[model samples]
Each structure stands twice: as C-alpha cells, then as structure tokens.
Target chain A: MATPTPTRQRRRGHDPESVLATAVGVFNERGYDGTSMEDLARALGVTKSAIYYHVPGKEQLLSRALDRALDGLFEMVADERASSGAAIERLEWVVRQSVRLLIDRLPYVTLLLRVRGNSGTELAALERRREFDRFISRLVTEAATEGSIRADVDPGLVTRLLFGSVNSITEWYQPARGASADDLADALLKMTFGGLRVDPAA
Target chain B: MATPTPTRQRRRGHDPESVLATAVGVFNERGYDGTSMEDLARALGVTKSAIYYHVPGKEQLLSRALDRALDGLFEMVADERASSGAAIERLEWVVRQSVRLLIDRLPYVTLLLRVRGNSGTELAALERRREFDRFISRLVTEAATEGSIRADVDPGLVTRLLFGSVNSITEWYQPARGASADDLADALLKMTFGGLRVDPAA
Candidate 1:
C-alpha cells in the first residue's frame, strides 16, 4: 500500500486485460469514433482516472484490442500444425484454428475487423492485417502448386474468399447463442475443404 | 440553362449517381466519420454547395450509398431466379448474381459493408442489412431442407459463411486488377455450390 500497487498488481476486478476485454465490447458497440473515455468509464463502472491508471487514452485502448486480435492470428500461422503439414493440410489446420480463435476472441477480433484506418494505430493494424493475409495467400499459393486444391482459382482470390467467409463470422456468431466452437469449426472445415480440395472422396 | 435543370439532369459529369459513386470511394477511404462534405467536394472536383445540390448532407450521401447496395441485393431475392428455382439452384443463381453485382457496384457495396451503425443513417442501413441477411438465411434453410446442400451446418451459419466469403470479394476484387466478374463468379460458384450442394457430382 505504501508505493501504490503497480497496474499489473491491481486488484483482480480491474486488471488491464479485463479492462481491455470490456473496452473491446464497448468499442465494437459504439465504434472507436463514437466512444470516449467517459463512455468507457461508464461501461466499466470506474472513473476516467481509474482507466487512465493503466492506459493512456482511447487510442491506446484501440491499439491494445487490435494487438490482441492480430497476435492470435499471427500465432496461428506460426503454430506447427499450421506451418508443417502438407499445404492443404496446413491450410485446413489454419482455417480450423482461425474459426476457433475468432470465437475465443470474438470481441477483440470484431473491433480489429471494423477498423477503417482513421488513426495511426488503425493504419498499423491494417498493415499487419495485410501481412497476415499475405502470409495465408502464400499458403494458398503453395497448396495450389501442390495440386492439393483447385488450380483454376487464383490463389489471391481464394485467400480473399476463404477469409472473407471467416471474418464475416464476427457479424453473426455469438458463442452464447449459437453453435459450439467445435461444431462451427467442423462445419466450416467441411464446407471450406469440400469446396477447396479437388475431390470429396480424397 | 433556361429551365435550370435539376441536379439529376444538370450534366453527365455531375449527376447524382456519379457524385454518389465518388462519395462512396471517399467514405471507404476516410472512415465515414473522418470524411466531410468539403472532403467529398474536393474528391469530386466540385464545390461543397454543388455536392449539397445533389445530396442534402454527408448523412444523405451515406444513406444513398447504402440504398444503392441494399436495393441491388433485395432485387436479387425478388428476381425469379432467386425466388423460384429449386433451393440450391436459386441459391446458386443468387451467389452468381451477388458476385456480378458486387463487382458492378463495387464502391457502393464496399461502403455498405463497412458501416458501423454509429448514426441514424447507419442504424437504418444496419436494419436493412439484417433484413437482407434474413432473406439469405431463409434460402440456406430451404436448401438444406430440400437436401440440396449439407444439412449438418445450421442454415443461419451457412448464410453467414456463404456471404462472408462472398462479401469478402470487396476486400480484394479490383475490376481493374483482377479476374473478370464471370471468372470470379465461376470460381465462387464452384466453391460455394460445391460445398453447399449435397451431391458433389450433381
């Protein structure tokens, strides 16, 4: 109590991570542009000063939320399952993991997906998003070259279509109301790989 | 000049539709909150008053752009091809037409896809989007019931997945840089119906 507990050591009720989680939901609902420190404080049931103790301002909160989503995504691509399997197998693994990740981090991912590059943080996030897309695009290109999927669709187009479908999950998926993550992942994989892999029997 | 032609009939270069088209691009680029009437006028090489002459304000520009996208989508469902054929066939037709429409009306559709519902116009557009999604969800349900597509996936989820992939076309499909609309539609249909239709062979 003498030195004033560091932000990390703050009580369980108001940790930075928990605050960011709550912040993500508010950001997604009201939009980064429409939300303010006062709004965030009101949602968190804390004063603006309390929020300030952990982060600088709304932009930093936005940056942290984007980082949370991008980190999960980039981590999936780096996972051995995503990196080591046959190109198609690896792609399937990434796709499955991506759905699971989207469900697990729904709020953060939702905020990241909706960013319009209005701020420095958002522009950086967009660049990282493009980097992530390029990484997957390479996987699709490799899968096509290996003849693991249809050769006719341009790999870039395939990447867009596949993730477009994946990212759209944010719009409708509610973990509390809908299909289980496993069920969602299983169905998505079937539809994705069914359309992707050249043959169903294979 | 004698009749003081209405803005719609003022000139080919300054028609409402063309001005709206330009506005869509600006909205997509600047995050609707970040854009202003002055920004729009600058983009169109017109005075702010000129833009106001065609559209009442920034909100109207956003509303009109959303209407353009929503109208095309509603028209598809009302079409004989979307409303009448076997569930799968109708869905395939809609999918094909959606791709073609997204390409043809790329800017309007892009702007519509990015709205975050922060204002009256956005909230209204969001409701219409939900209506459009509900329409598609019904199609997927009918298709599943007819055994024309996989029944394991929830039709609601299927609608999201199908459109997620389809709507994603806006992220990357540049008519100037990529595949022809026919080519994009062909690949998407093959992937979409290939995964959706119950029988891969049929």
Candidate 2:
C-alpha cells in the first residue's frame, strides 16, 4: 500500500495541542457558553465522533485551556524572584512576569479573564483565579507595610488597578502589530511605579 | 374602570428605561450574542411580544444602551475642562470623569466595553468608541508635546494603559460595597499620575 500524502496527513493531524489551540480561539470568539461541540467540530474540520479522539469533552478542554493560563501564574508565584526579593521589588517582578505570561499565552489568559463562573469548570477556574488575586493582594500589602509603596491607597485597590492595567492588554493587544511583551511591561511599570508627569526639578 | 393599584401598576410597568436596563443586564450576563429575545423577556418577567411592544428589537435596545455610555464620554470630551486646560490636566479631568461615568452608568458602560462589533449596532458603537479613543489619544499626544507628560514613554501607550486601568473598574466594581467614585478616582489618579512609590526626599 502507498504511504499517505502530505495533504492527507495534514488533514488528519488533530493533535492535542492543535485541538486545544483551536478550541481556545473558538471559545474566545464566541464565548465558552455560546460555543458548542458542533462549533468545535466545524472549527477542527472533524466529525463530532472524531473529536472524542481528542480529550474527553468540552469541559475537559476548558479545564486544560484554563490550566495553561493558571499554571503559568502559579509557576510565576513559586519563582524565586517572586519570593525572595524586597516586597516592592518582588511585586514589580511579578507584574512584569504577568505581562509576559499573558502575552505568551494570550488566548488562554484572555479566556481565563472572561470566565464568569457559569459552570463547574468556570467556577473552578474562578476559584483558582481568586487565589491568585489573594497572593497579589498580599504582595501589595507587604509592599505598603515595608514603606516602598505609598501608604495613602488601599493595598486591595492598588492590586486591582495595577493588574487591571496589565489584564487590559488582552482586550486590545494584537501580537503581530503590538509592542513586544518586554516593551509593554516597561511602559506599564514606568507609568504605575514612576509618575507619568514630568518632574520640573529633574 | 377602577384605578389600577400600585403593585398591579408595578407588575405591568415595563417602561422604555426599565426595558433597556433589563436588556442590558441580560446582555451583560449571557453576553449580547449569547442572549436571545426570550432571555431578555424572561429577565423582564414579560413575554417576548411585550418586549417588542416597548422597543422595536434587541438591536435598538443595544444602540440606546451604548449611546447612554458614549454620550457621557462625548459630553466630557466637549466640556470646557476637557478642552481648555493644560493638556495633562485636561487628560486628568477626562480620566476622573470617565471613572465616575463608568460607575454612574455601570451596566451600560460595561456593555459598551464588551462590544466586539458583530452586528451593525455593535459596529456603530465601536466606531463611536474609537472616536472617543482618538480624542484621548490626542490629549495624550498634546500633553507629551507640551512636555507636561514624560517624553520617554510613548503617548499612545500611556493613553491605553491609563484608560485600560479606568475601564477595568467595570469588571470588579460593586457599587453597594465598593469605594465611592471620588475615592476610586483619587486612588487611580494618585497611582498613575503621582506614582505608587513613596518619594525618597519628600
């Protein structure tokens, strides 16, 4: 028997990575609640039965996709840079790493940010997300306590605004045309950490 | 006929304002694309036909809801404060007003921010949103040109990060328990304009 052609091989290649990537794209575009197995099947160019050859089901796919984002964050939280530095410096490192992670895993992180806890999968993802928020909140509080951060603003509020600017990158960032992740992180850090206004004396 | 009672009047009451507000709530919850006419009707405790009696259709409601947010932004843009001051101060005023508007008309602005341009209504709203963004971009550029803003960072990037933080308020703000608009603006301005770090000499 003759070997399969390249076209046939490419058509049949519904690997786990490709499937997850396609599913994430469809989820981001239509929203997880709006997307169905049929939509995923159509996007994957595979029959519904063939899709079962992938991971178990939509929720499982969602779990994996959310983990792609959550795992990156958890890994960052465990990094030595995040743990060993002065509180303000550690907070800066974490924020920079988060910007890089969000850009590196843009689709997964975007999907994670939009989760509204409508299902078991979404609820679990949200709980994990809240845990991450609490970690950042502590860093902010520690920085405030150390007197590196200004004392006037609430630590909780600081966490929200600082990361809010970071997360908003997902809304408008187009990887092909946008600044590199480092450049984006630098501008964000400078604006939030150093004032945007010009210093007259300097 | 006997006069209608207050409870009966309330039950039957589906005014234009109430209908738009309810539709926006359902849209935000289920997403504009995910929500059906039936969902909006169910949310309002009315039949689908009753919804049509109040408004022409869902798109009309969306257009009105978007206008509610956009009108507030454009009004701020046209104000003397937004136009007459040093560009940096003008930009500051705009940001503060935007935070207040987002809080005041939280649902409508939330809906506006989530628009992805799927339909003609969404497309129109997006165009208006872009126009507002252009107004802001110009303000940032003007501030940079006037040397009131730091020259090293790109004005376009600054505008995005600054407003991105402001717009992110809708994702987590809970009016009943959260900080008042003035306080929220103060924190945001203090962080972005004055910087979050403690000054060494001061």
Candidate 3:
C-alpha cells in the first residue's frame, strides 16, 4: 500500500512512537487485559480502522511494548561494563544501569513488571524477565564468590532484594518531581553497597 | 441469625477464618477486581446462597482481608518496641517485624500491596498504607538526625527502598519452601541495616 498523504498523516497526529506510548499508558491505567481495541482507538484519538493500519491487533502492541522494556534489559546484559572488572564492580555497574534503563523507559518497564503470563505474549515477556533475573543472580553469586559481598546472606536472596528495591522505584517514581536517575541509583547503591549505617571507624 | 447445624457446617467446611483465608488466596491469584462472588463461591466449594450466609458481599470480604494485613502493621506501630528505643533501633525492630508480618499474612499483604483505590474499601486501605509509610519515613529521619544511619541519602528515599525490598518478599516467597520469617528478617537487616559489603578492615 502507498504511504498516506502528508495531510492525512498530519491530521492523524500519531506516529508509531506516540501510538505505543499512548497504548502503554492505557494498558498501565486499565491493565492490559482490561483494555480493548476501542479503548486504544479512543486514547489515540484515531478511528479503529486507522489503528489497524498501524498495528494488527492488541497482542501485537503488547508484544512491542514488552519488547521496549525487555530490550533495554538485554542491552544492559550485553554491555561490557556488565561483564568486565571485578564481579562486585560489575554488579554495581549493572544495578546502576538497570536504574537508568527503568527510569528512561518508565512506562514500558512499569507495564513489564505488571505482566502475569496471561497470554503467549505475556508468557514470553515473563520468560525474558526471568532470564534478566538469572543474569543478576549470577552477578550476585560471583560477587559473593569473589569475597567482596558478605557471605552469610544467601546470594539468591540478595539478588531478589537488590532488584526488588530497584523495581519498586516504578511504583512511586514521578519523573517531573522525583530525583534524577543518577541520584536514585546513587542513593540505592549507597544504601545497599556501602551500607546505611555510619562507619564507626570514620 | 441462628448458627447452622454442626453437620451442615462440617459439610460446608468453612469457618470465618477459613473463609477469609480462602478468599484472600483467590484475591491474590486473580486480583480483587478480576475476582467475582461466583469465583469465590466456586473456590469455597459452596453455593452462592451459602456464601451470603457467611458474609454480605465481596467488598465486605475485601475490607476484612485488608484489615488482616493493616491490623498487623498497626499492632506493630502500637508496640513498645517501636516507641521506646533509639530511633535507629526502633526502625530496625519495625523493619524486622514488617518482614514477619508480610510473611505471616502473605496473601493479605499481597492483596494490600496490589490495591489501586478502585473502591471505597481500597481507598481507605491506601490511606492507611500511606500512613504506615509516613511512620517509616519519620523513623528514618530520626535515625539520620541521630547519626546512626548515613545522612547523605534522603530518608524518604531510604524508607522506600528499604521497605521496597521487604515488600518484594511477597512476590517470590513460598511459605512451604522459603526461609522462615526470622531467617528472612535477619538477611534483610544484615543487608539494609548492617550493609551487604564485607568489612575490609576485618
């Protein structure tokens, strides 16, 4: 099919980026399962036929939205910073980057965290999420093995709690008024890494 | 209304405690909004009429279930341990107790965490939850002022990340196979309060 006329595109007012952003906002507000194609159309201010021209169905949109979050994570996983240096340093870098990614893609990440494997797309997303968890878990284990982190607490538990704190940012973070991603990551790392208590020796 | 016959009660196999427990389980699994009275009835293995004999409606059950979690938190707030100690010690005690409370009433707390204020009952619960967060924030501030916890990080952010770790326990904690409440609390305290890094001087 030929591209739409420039005037038609201007009248529609939604590009792919805006469409996904609006769809994610609706999904987060009403929940993915509760939202409908008509809801998406209403949110986009476009007719249902126009939405179909952009995407095939709701599931396709869900897949793309989930990928927006998952892809950021996998990109972090592949980064040299995550793989190099001492295990503890690498772990710290990954956690900081994770915070940046979560903040950068707040809506998508929020949607990703709320997925419950309700459909094939959701299940796939959950699988990728688990894979990300496994990567973090390995970093924690390596940090423990290298004798940088304390040994008494289980590494698995550490991974969960550390990332749990990271994930919780999505629940309360307001970008307009909240701390920048660097400040959030610094606060989190300081609390979890250097410890929250004042050093007696200092 | 008069009580049902013992034989009938035995056949129905649900007391108030059991009914609430079962309802919370269903709520956690399917979410409060997604769950219906018919679903609760089916899960309880009783007729819809039989369910009404025990409780008035879903909202009533939700109120009770939310109370189960909130009451535990309020009880902790009322305890002498939370009030009489150094702010840092009291904060530690509160965090430990919160882990125990979340574990002890896993389903109830899980349900509480997922609430989004869609109804009067949920709105009331959300208000109570914010009150709890404020209580924690004050303790963190006190601890920082006392120079116990580090002062550089914002106390409010500290409270959020600290409890964010604690609350995340409900996401993966398995009562049958997971660590006991004491063990969980110990690990959490050691990480957030004592710090996760090994002492280089040691």
Candidate 4:
C-alpha cells in the first residue's frame, strides 16, 4: 500500500462532518446540555483534540445542527411561497414539505424539538421557529379567508397544532426502518387534513 | 391592630400545600434543574429551612409536582372509562378531561413534559407516563374494535395524536386570558377530529 494510507485505520478528512453527525446523534440521545465533548469524541471513535480541530466546541456543533434544520425549514417556506396554489393548497404543501424536511433531516429536527429556549443559541432557534409559526399562521388565515378552512378557530392555534402534528412525528419515527419521507406525509395528511371519521353523518 | 400571631404569617394548616404549589409555579418557570430552594423560598416569602421542612429536597419537589400531573391523567382515564355512554363518547370524554387536566394542573404538566428521564426519579416518572399511555392505548384499541372509531390506523398512534392535541395546549394557553379551558377543548376537538377542511359538498 502506497505511503500506508491513513484511511485504513483513521478517519482523516471525514472527521469533521462525521464528528458533527455523531454529535447530533449524541445530543439527540442525551440532550445538548446533558452531553459533553468527551462523550462525543468517544462516540466518534476519535480523540478529543480530533473533535476540536473540526469544531470550536460543543456549542458550535449545536449551532451547526440548528443551522441545518432551520435552513431546511426556511427553504421549505420560501418554496411554498413561490408555489402557485390556493391558500389551503399552499398550507397542505407546506405540511408536506415540512414533513419531508423533518424526515430528510431527522436528527436536526429532533434536536430542534427538544430545545427549551434555555441557551442563547436555543433561544435564537426558538425565535426562528416562531417566525416559521407566523408564516404558517398567515397561511391559515389565508385559507380561512378563502373559505377553504373553518373560520371558527384562531389561526394561531391552528398553526401551532399543525406544527405540533409535524413535530411529533420525530418522537416515534424510526429512521432505521427505512420509511420514506412521503410515506410519513401520507399518514399525516390522512389523519390531519382528511378527517379520520368517514362521512355518512359528517 | 393587635400583633398577629407567629402562626398567622404561615397560615394555620395550608402552608405546606401552598408552599408546594408556589414551588411548582417557579419550577415550571425555571425548570427542575435550573430552579433552587432559594428561588422557591423567594417565591413563597419563606425561609430555606421552611421549604426543607415541607419537602426533603428538590427531587422531592419535582416528584410531588409530577405526581400531581400523573394523578390527574390517571384519574381522567378512570373517570372517562366508568362514566361513558359509548366508546366514541368515552374517547371524547377523555379528550375534554385531558384538556381540563392540563389547565387545572398547568405547572405540574409543564414540568412533567420537560423532564429528560435523566435521574432515577425522572425515569420513574417516565415509566408511569408509559403506563398511562398503555392504559389509553387500551381504550383506543377497544374503541376501534367496537367499531366506534376508525380501525385503519394503529390504536397506539391514535392515542399519541389524541394526547398530542391536548398536551400542546400548555404551549399557548394563558389562564389569565379570556380563553378558558372549555374554549380550548372546543377549538381543539374541532381542529383534531373535525379538521380544518370544509365538506366537499358544502
């Protein structure tokens, strides 16, 4: 073997991304504050200094994880805004896309859901989440204005419930089971938008 | 005015319960780990020893708070099960009872939701929660089997979504506001079982 390539026994260039992903997994399992850098490196099969070279510290890893989740979320909002559809159509579109975002970036979404607005970083993530909520509330208002949805309830509450429905998916969804993103969207839509109660008396 | 007796400052017999309630309020605000006995005393205008006399430690306070929430939940299940006309009736009864339970036991439920299953006591609370879930899941399965509800999806998922709809009330509910627990349950019931979409023929 030429030069005795370090790839055989060492994680060389893969250290950074691999370490970050490992950090996310650990953070999700033990929570951000509950986990330490030592635990992360041990999980990553690397020395603590090896993790340091990639990220400044655990906070940076959390920030990176949140950045990824928020990017996906904001991208979904941007795409839905541009998508030409009725308001209810747009709301459903957002729901589907949000579900996809959660599934595609499951660990990040899990971390996002667990944040309690304790840290500065977490508070920022929560604020970004509020902005996302405001976006959904506007869509719900539009849907009600279009007479596409029930006008009786507050739009904000509806938006929270909608978001809660999607966020709750991460609690039970198994990534290892290989369920597709669209499959989750299908189940959610069936239960949420489409009423579970069939219509003879509906 | 004549000098008040020393017992007057502490109230005759309600002091411990009042102190525990005050402790729960602050615990809900600051989280279990973040809160201190000093904070509890400051909230109650009592000395640190007073708090220690009432409860053994912070963990005991947490356990007491969670016990209140858990007791409410378990009672809801029992009450709903015994005082029902039909299976669907029982399900709706449980939902409304749950929303009321969350509101009546706001601080306790909030603390219960935030526990991370980190400590032994926390783990016990988590186990009790799972037992509650299994009990509700049994109701959901029985309802489906009796043909009072949709039998297409798993009963476990239905139970999760049912609580998902109720547990989320704490995120936005304000007891001081004009919005009452009944109002929340009404809106939530419509948003959940009825959904936001209009009838196709309407």
Candidate 5:
C-alpha cells in the first residue's frame, strides 16, 4: 500500500495542536480555574483518558498556548526589522508587528493576557511576559538615548504604556467588526510614536 | 438603652461596606466564578449566613463592588474640573482624576477591570464601563474638532488607546515601588497630549 499522506495519518480525530486550540477557547471562556480536564475533554468530544494520552493536564495546555504567544513575540523582536533599524524605526516595527501578532493569534494571546499568577503555570507565564517586557524596554531606552524619542518619561514606563495599548487590543478587537489589523497597527504606531518622537518640523 | 454608635453596631464582625471590600478581595484573588460564598466567609472570618445578612450572595457582592468603582468614575466625570474646561483641558483633568481614583481604590478598580461578563453582574458592570468610555470619547472628539488634538485617528480609537494605557495600570502599578500617582499621571498626560496637541512652536 502507498504510504499514508500526512492528512490521512490523523484519522483519530484531533492532533495535539488542534486539541490545545480547543482547550484555549474553553479556558478563555470559562477561565482556567473554572475549567477542568473533563471540560476540555467534553469540549473536544473526546474521553478524558484520550486527552491524557496527548497531554498531562489543563496546566500543560495553558503553558503551551501561552508559549505560542510568547514565541510569536520573541520572533518579532528577532526579526531584522525589529533588530537592525534606527531605534525609533525599530520600536515602531516592534509595535506594528505586535499588533499584527495580537490580532492573528487572538485566542492564544488572550489566554496569556488573562493569566494572573493563580498557579505555578500562570506564575511562570507571567515571568516570561516580564522578560519580554524587559527586552522591549531596552529598545525604548536606546531610542530615547539616540534622541529619536523623548527622554522625560522612564523607558520602562514607555514600554508598559506601549505594550499595554497593544495588549488591550485583545480586549476590544473583533476581526470582522473593527478596523483591519494593518489599519489598527497603523493607528497604534501613530498614537504611540506620534507622542514619543520629537517634532521633525521643529 | 443607649442607641449603638455605627462602630458599635458592627459588633457582628463586619458591616456591609467592609464585607463588600472583603468580597472584592476574594473575588479578585480567586475570580468571581472560582470563589464561593463559603470561601468569602472564610476569608472574612465570618459565617456564610453572616455574609448573607449584609449581601444576598456572591453576585450581589460583585455588583456592589463594581458599583463603587463606577460611582467613583462617574463622580470624577461630574467634577467641575472634568466638566468645565476646554476639551483638551477637560480630558486632561479626567485622566488625572482617573489615575487618582484607580490608586485610591486600587482593589475595587482592579476587580472592576477583571470582569469578563461571565455573569449578569459582570455584564452589567461592563455596560456601565462602556457608558463611561462613551462620555470620554465625546471629549476626544471635541478636542479634535477644536484643533486641540490630531484628528487622523477615530475618536473611539483614541479613547481606547488612552484608557488602555491608563487601565493597564492596575496590572503592574505598585504604589510603593513605582512613580507617585501625581508623577505617573503627569507622565501619562505628557506622553498622551505631547503626541496629540498641535505644536505651537512649529
């Protein structure tokens, strides 16, 4: 017989990724603590035992989902646009790319945003989030030092406001109803940098 | 017999306001759904029946807490400083006052920010929050029209970014460790209005 195609290989129903996606939806809806392993299994139309075969428990699902969001963010920072441009340019690129990531990976980022250190899994996620913020704060500091942005406010404060504005997107953005990601990203870049950058005309 | 003073009347361990404050703490810590009446009573060192005497149930506690937050915000808007200034000035006043309220009632506002419409109480709070936003968005629109702020972005969008930056405060602000509320509010005003206002020098 011919070798099975990748699509045909998973005849059982759900793969690990697909399973995790469903778990994220349930987690976001009912909250992590409110949800149970059985809830995930029920939502996935599978037996609880079947779920255990793929992942240990609910916490693993949360960690994996948040990892996906953090990976996207870290990758954005590592991209050439974020890493090599003039400080302001780089900051703008990071902001724009972040808006794109937030919209594109709404559910995963939503789950990550809602983690409140209620458990070990959540506390670990919060740490990674801080690490990401620290990485970005360095960029803000560099931009300020380079005279591309204002120096009055603390770099760390700028990072908080910038990412806070970006993160708030997951709270209000509905893909079909609001402006497109590109449009919203453009607005974010304008709202943020428009304030941070010195007047070119002056 | 002498009528008991207000303080002496609460010999039953807690009053309605104190009970609600304790409820907000428990609700925020465990989440509204994750928390139970028994959990709340235990936290307050009281019986469930004692809690019920002051409040009907967990939902009432949530509604009461959110109402306190909402009342503070509306009061800020109603203040002469927030209501009578030029559009930009009024907006600034509202922003500064909001930061003060957030800090003054940190736990209450923190609980308010975390509501996700998981229940009727949350949904009602969410609606009131939107009303507050609508009130602010009008100020933004007025500012743009008065040539006080850039009009490139939608007023509603500006409102979201502005409040998003402000609302994110509850996430990371630790009063003792970070900038004072006055200093932070000043920075917020500078960061926001600096980008927004028309450059007089230019």
Candidate 6:
C-alpha cells in the first residue's frame, strides 16, 4: 500500500504553554471549583478534546502549574542551604531567591497559593508545600540558636510572617511594568529585617 | 375560615439562624463561586425557596456575611483612632482589635480574604477593604514619623506585612486549642517592630 501522508501537526494552533497560561488565568478568575473544562474550552475557542490532548485533566493542569512553582521554591531551599554564608545571611539569600521565584512564576505561584487540596493530588501538593515551610522554620530555629535573630520572636510565627510578606507580593505585583522581582525581594527584605523604625531613640 | 397554622413551627426543621450557619459553612468550604443555592439548601435540608425567605438571594447572603466582618474591622479603626493613646499606642490598639475581630468572624473573614472581586458586590466589598487598608497605612506613616516604628521599612510595605501576619493567623488557628487571638496579636507586634534578628548585639 502507498505510504499515507504523515498526520498534520495536531496542536499547531494550540500551544500547550499558552493553553496552560489560559487555564491559569481562568482558574485565577473563577477559582478551581468555579472553573470547568467547558469554561476553558470556551475561552480557547476549542473543544474539550483539544484541552484533553494538551492536559490530561483539570487536576493535572493544576498539578503541573503547582509543580512548576513548587520546584522553584524547593530549589531555592536546596540552593540556599548549600551556599556559603552565616545563617542570617543565608536566610536573606533565600528570601531574595524566593521573591524572584514567586514573581517569575506569578501565575503558577498564585494558583499554588490557592490550592485547598480536596483532591488526592492536591493533598500531596499541600504536603510538599508544608514540607517546604518546615524547611524554612528549621532555618529560623537554627538562626535563633546562633544568636543571629531575635530569640524572643517565636520561630513558627516568624516563619509565617516571612512567608506571608513574600506571598503578598503575588497579590499586588504586575510584571508588565513595575519593580523587578529582585527589587521587590530587596525591598521586602530591607523593610522586614531592618524594621520600619527610622529613628530609634537609644 | 380558621387561621392557617404555621407549617415551620409544626415541622422539625432547620431554623433561619441554623440555616445561615450552614450557609456560612458551605460558603467557606466551597468558596463563593464554588457554592450554589442548591448546595446550601441541600446542606440544610431545605428548598431553595426556603433560603430565599431568609436571604433574598446569594448576593444578599454574601453581603450579610462579608459585611459582618468588614464592620468589625472598620469598627477597630474608628475605635482605635478615637481611643485615648499616642500614635503608636493607637496602632497597637488597632492591631489587637483586628486580631480579635478576625477570630470572631473567622468564616466571614476567610471569605473576605479569598475574594478576588469578580462580582460587583465583591468588588464593592474589596473597595471598602482597600479603604480600610488605606486607613491602616496612614497609621503606619504617622507612627513612623512619630518615631513609634523604625523608618527603614516603607509604610506601605510595613502595612502589608503587618496585616499579612495578622490575616495568616486565620489559616492555621483553631479556637479550641490554639493561641488566643490576643496572644497572636502581641506576638505580631513584637515581630513586626523588632523582627526575628537578635538586637542585643547593638
């Protein structure tokens, strides 16, 4: 039999990356439950099957997006832990890297932030996120012991405060025209570690 | 004709208050969009029309819930601003009141926290929320000028971090066995003012 012509590229019009980006936007707009495959299909002007071809399912799409951000965060932990520096310095380094990562992966990180984990995959992601938190908590504990940080501040509270400050960047930041991620990181760190008290009376 | 007997009084069923409590639960569990009128009705074992009797519509229900929390927050600002205290003291007072308000209105506050303002009502609520934020930011600016806080931190950033820390308490705090809101507030003040770093070296 004559060789059949090779099949046309299936997703030439539909790039997976752009599709995922659209999914994040929809998820961000409507939230997880509020959004559906149909909504995504409508936005893309394509059929559900096309989305299925790009992503196995909605959960997988969520997983993929979260995994990308989680990977960036986890890598920061590993890299910061390896770099040569005192505990506080290392903590500051981690803060800078984290802000950069959060800003760079804004959509993914925004989605990651909203994950409630009613699903098995999401529960796993939450576990991983918690593990990442614990890693930072341990660093704060060690830094406290080294007399690098104030001993009075509860380490757990400190951990939450730091992450909270970092995470708020996701709320107001727009990469289109504003401070770079590193600039934000520096600003956050300077304000946080340094304190807002400009004229401390001895 | 004989007066018609009230069916609700005759039947063993959910009351309006109980239904509202259940609606709040559903709202928190599934979020605003994730929830439906049917979901609330089903969760309460009532018909949708029954809900309408108590709460004209979903928008009214959300408004009632969100308004409760917003009222508590705005009350704090007004109460603190009017209280007998210095600038720093007023700020501290507001912080304490806010934490208490947060715990008292946990579900409503959670819903408030999750709002992305896709709806007109939510957008209005968000605008009011920003007005609250602006009020708090003013306190930060004045407090910094008064030497109540360190000036190294930007007032806007400090405001975000302080509230971020306070709001984060709702995420992990359980009223049964967790630290009281007051304790959380006290811890937040110290952390924000002095930070995690040990300052005795000075």
What is the two-chain DockQ of model 1?
A: 0.36
TM-score of 3: 0.94
Model 1, B1-202: lDDT tens digits are 5675565455457677788888888888877888888998888876767766656688888888899999999899889888887887888888889988999999889888887778989999999989988888898888777776777777777777888888888877767778888998887776666642233243
Q: Which ranking of candidates, highest TM-score first?
A: 2, 3, 5, 6, 4, 1
Residue A57 alpha-carbon offset, candidate 3, angstroms: 1.1
Tens digit of lDDT per residue, candidate 5, span B40-149? 87888766676666667877778888988999999887888877867878888898989889988998999999887878888989999999999999998888887777
Question: What C-alpha lDDT does candidate 4 achieve relative to the native structure?
Answer: 0.78
Evaluation by TM-score, superior candidate among 3 and 6:
3
Stretches off by above 4 angstroms in model 3 are A1-7, A10-12, B1-7, B10-12
How good is chain A of candidate 6, measured by TM-score? 0.89
Comparing 3 and 6 on lDDT, the stronger one: 3
Off by over 4 Å in 6: A1-10, A80-84, B1-17, B80-85, B200-202
Q: Model 5, range A52-77, lDDT digits (tens) per residue?
A: 76556877788899999999988887
What lDDT tens digits, residue by residue, belong to model 4 across residues B1-202? Answer: 8886885756554366776788888877766776887887678776777766555678887788889999888877777363566666677778788888888888889889777787998999999999988877887777777776667766777677667767776766788873788887887778766778986578
User: For model 6, how does the per-residue alpha-carbon lDDT over A1-202 read when each residue is reduced to its tens digit?
Assistant: 7654432244555577887888888988788767888898887777767667666688888888888899998888778363567888888888888888888889899888888887987899999999988888888888888888877767887888778878877777778976777667766776567654443455
The iRMS of the candidates, in order, is: 5.4, 0.9, 1.0, 2.0, 5.1, 2.4
lDDT of 2 by residue, B1-24 (tens): 999997467556877788889899
lDDT of candidate 3 over A1-202, digit per residue (tens):
9899985875567777888898999999999989999899888777777768755689988999999999999999999998989999999999999999999999999999999889999999999999998998898889889899998998888889898899999999999999999999999999998888887667
For every prediction, compared with the true complex, DockQ reads: 0.36, 0.81, 0.76, 0.43, 0.40, 0.46
Report the alpha-carbon TM-score of model 4 versus the true structure: 0.85
Pairs of residues at least 3 apart in sequence or in different chains that clash in candidate 3: none
Error of 2 at B180 (Å): 0.3
Q: What is the TM-score of chain B in candidate 5?
A: 0.87
**Clash totals in order:** 1, 0, 0, 0, 0, 12
Q: Write the per-residue lDDT of candidate 2 for residues A61-126, one digit (tens) a residue.
A: 999999999999999999999999799999999999999999999999999999998899899999
| C-alpha TM-scores of all predictions | 0.82, 0.95, 0.94, 0.85, 0.89, 0.88
